[model samples]
Target: MNLNTFIQKKINKQLIFPFIILAIVSGIFFMSIGFRTTITTSKIELEKAVEKWNNTFTNMENFLEFLSYDNNLIDNTEKLGEILKNFYNKFQNKISYIYFSTSSKNILIYPETDMINGINPNTRPWFINASKNKEKTQITEPYVDHITKDIIITISKYVNGMNISGVIGIDINPSFLNDILSNKDLLLISKNNIILFSENKNKIGKTFNIPTKSERFISKNILLITKEAKGNVYIVTYKNLFLELLPYYFISLVSIFLILFLGKIVNKNINTELKNSIAMPLETLVNEAKNYLNNQTFDSSKITSNIKEIEVLINEIADMISIIEANFQELKATNEELLDAYNEIEKYSGELESTYELFIEKMSNIVEGFDENTGNHIKRVQILSEFLAKKLGLPKTLVRQIYLYSPLHDIGKIKVPPEILTKPGPLSEKEWKIMKNHTIWGAEILDGDPRLEIAKKIALYHHEKYNGKGYPFGLKGELIPIEAQIVNIVDVYDALRSKRPYKKALSHEKAMEIILKGDNRTSPNDFNPKILEIFKKYEEEIKILWDNLNDNK
Candidate 1:
């Protein structure tokens, strides 16, 4: 019947119960598998810890055997000292001290101790036990050191040579032994039922009575895997099953949640498909028809649907829309032709503007040539002006304007007498007055064109000073256009560096010094302070531009 009812019925009848069953089954299966995996992983980790402890204890036994090989135990004092030094350095953190006890009442200790030579070696349990059993190494129970007062275990071997019978003993910190036992969930227990090393420090040095009956042991829940180390036995216990299964339980919970969430998403998508296949297509066709009636334009693409009734309805609406769209397209084609004609007219207008700009640029160049300025000088000023404008963060359009119009800064020189403009000697005050009026004349010349607005500003105010002592308009500080300020500094710098009719070209260093520090006709005050700072920052770049454009070079 209806799409919504059909989709809901399909999901309820086929999907919901099946998904619920699958979620329950997957969660139970995952928990079973995961719990077993976690238990196995714990067992492997515990075994690794035991193997590591066994390896370390074996190394100690090997070291003791190495020490027993020495025949001249007392006479080879330097050799023994070197051996002890190496052992102490390597195992210093674990072994507090290592010493050799001889039958002659002498003790040689590593990390030298204050014990006197006359002390009896037989009085010590490690020495007595090792000396008694010459074949096997002895590991004595934990004892407080007499000197350091720290808990220590002694690993010793009895040594017998031609004239020597003694014990080679290494006193290890019990903490090092505890580290191995505790890491593996193990306890080091003595034959006397005393816990020597355990993960729980309170149990160490404490005795635990063993139950006589197997039933009692089972009731007490005592389970252990034992490994004998010398005389002591290490007991490994299983980790808590609940704690080990936590991660697996968490994963199972997540999997169930994810399954349920996916079921909801699938149900949502079914409803969405119903809407898209029936309701959305019908709504789109109605809206498109309304848009065609009101706005004379409609989407011509066919409306798609999966439902037979909806598809047939969409086809009928599409046929009516097609006829309306045809009339609209005919009008659209006519309007496009009119638009093309207007664009063609605009293209011709743009070409005329470009021609006018080229004419202005050529006129500016002619004026510069008449003023005895080199073509290269104008080009260099344009480069320097553009650099300063960009460094000052001017917009790209303005920066381009500065580059294009900077050469026109002296266009006013066209009205000045040629002889006066190219004078090889310094100008008199009256002649300077006339020369200064060129700024006013240049502004007037470029005043009529909107495209030359930037050029007009530069021509009028290029000679103006930041400190207000400049000519023509006497504009000061920010009163001058930034474009004019940019061209002014660059114009002055290029003029100083270029060989003019009246002045020889100066070195870049000398020219910069005069520009920054002031000369006869201009000073640092003549330039904008910000512009000056930008010029200084890019001083090297400007100098390179100058050198490359130098006509004399």
Candidate 2:
């Protein structure tokens, strides 16, 4: 051949061989795209089916829960049958039968089936499973129905009440599962690889061999979606690969011819179009990142770029923001919990104070009731002590302590003999000495209780004279606690105005006269001069209190 002809033939060979290879690759790519689309569509449909099945299972579970709460159905065969009939009517097509069995082996079946009696339900799998799982509903392994010969699964719940307790069961027919699979070749397999149900009748009740890596076509099996329901695994398989790829096969042939015509021009335009598509979206992404950093919030939904890389980055940022938001919500919940705890502590403190006040009032009543002074004497003493303490410019907390504790000052009188207390005449010197021991007795009674510190001090020292001549310890001047000193004056003033078994009730003016100036019976030197001065100043207020308290008389 001539040299020019040889060169032209070689060029033709090079061009033809490359075109053939490109056509083959293009055909493979188009077919792969079609297969991916088919798999995606199948996955969506499988999810919908799985969700429907899950909803149905949830409905069955809810119904079982409802039956468990029916106390009337438990142990009452007639009521149980009535309820079962209602349940069967409500789900007649989906359920094969409804029955109940008690712990005592008594069985009740709806639709009036004649079964053998005296069979222990505790030995049954449904009862055992329901009893074992006390916290949730239980589902038994699939079994053939004795009457209809249809495959069925039983859902059971344990019933609990005073006199009625047993297991309630409902047999569900899985025939309706075919509608969820939409006539697809789906198998409901147990965890042990036993096929519970299948679209193909022969496959049911057979052991299934799960596909291994070597046996499965990874690309074709992408259409298979496995979902779990009530511990059973469902495998949905899509076949017919060739029919799904037919349209792509024709389109690939057309693409090969177009590629030969436009191959040289396409490469130049592709880079330009790619840059235009990516540039604006990339810039927008950068601006969004800046905004997210600056403001700590980003509208991820607004980021709708078609570029794969930008979309991926946007999704990652959205995930990070979601994590931060979740952490913020958790922190907010923790803060609310802390606030609740603080409020609880405050409520407890107020309740404690109120309880302390109530206890003090009760103790005062016991002492007064025992002493037989029935005209609100303890109440008047508490009021008068509180008034004197405040007028003496004591701190509010100390004044409150004095108010609550002063009423219990004479609790020692309980130890005194009733005859000695109720005597209408002056006592013998020995009896008077016994009466003086009440102060020591009151102190002993109130001691060791940290909550009654003021009560103990007042009870022990209220009779101690300011000049060191009083009974008990004989504490003088500032040596005695101010609480006791305040109560001492108030107690004596109330006693003078009150009618005692031993003495006529003195007038308020006479009581003040004896307190301010020395009398034949008592002297001003017996009280703290400071407390006595404040008392004289507020004597009118004290008289008003006595009059008001005595008004009930």
Name the best candidate (by TM-score). Answer: 2
Give the residue spans of candidate 2 off by over 4 A: 1-325
- Which pairs clash in model 2? none
TM-score of each: 0.40, 0.41
CA-lDDT, candidates in order: 0.76, 0.76
lDDT of 2: 0.76
Model 1, span 374-475: residue lDDT tens:
647777777788888889999999998998888889899999988888887998998888999999999999999898899999999998889998878687
Worst 10 residues of 2 by lDDT: 212-221
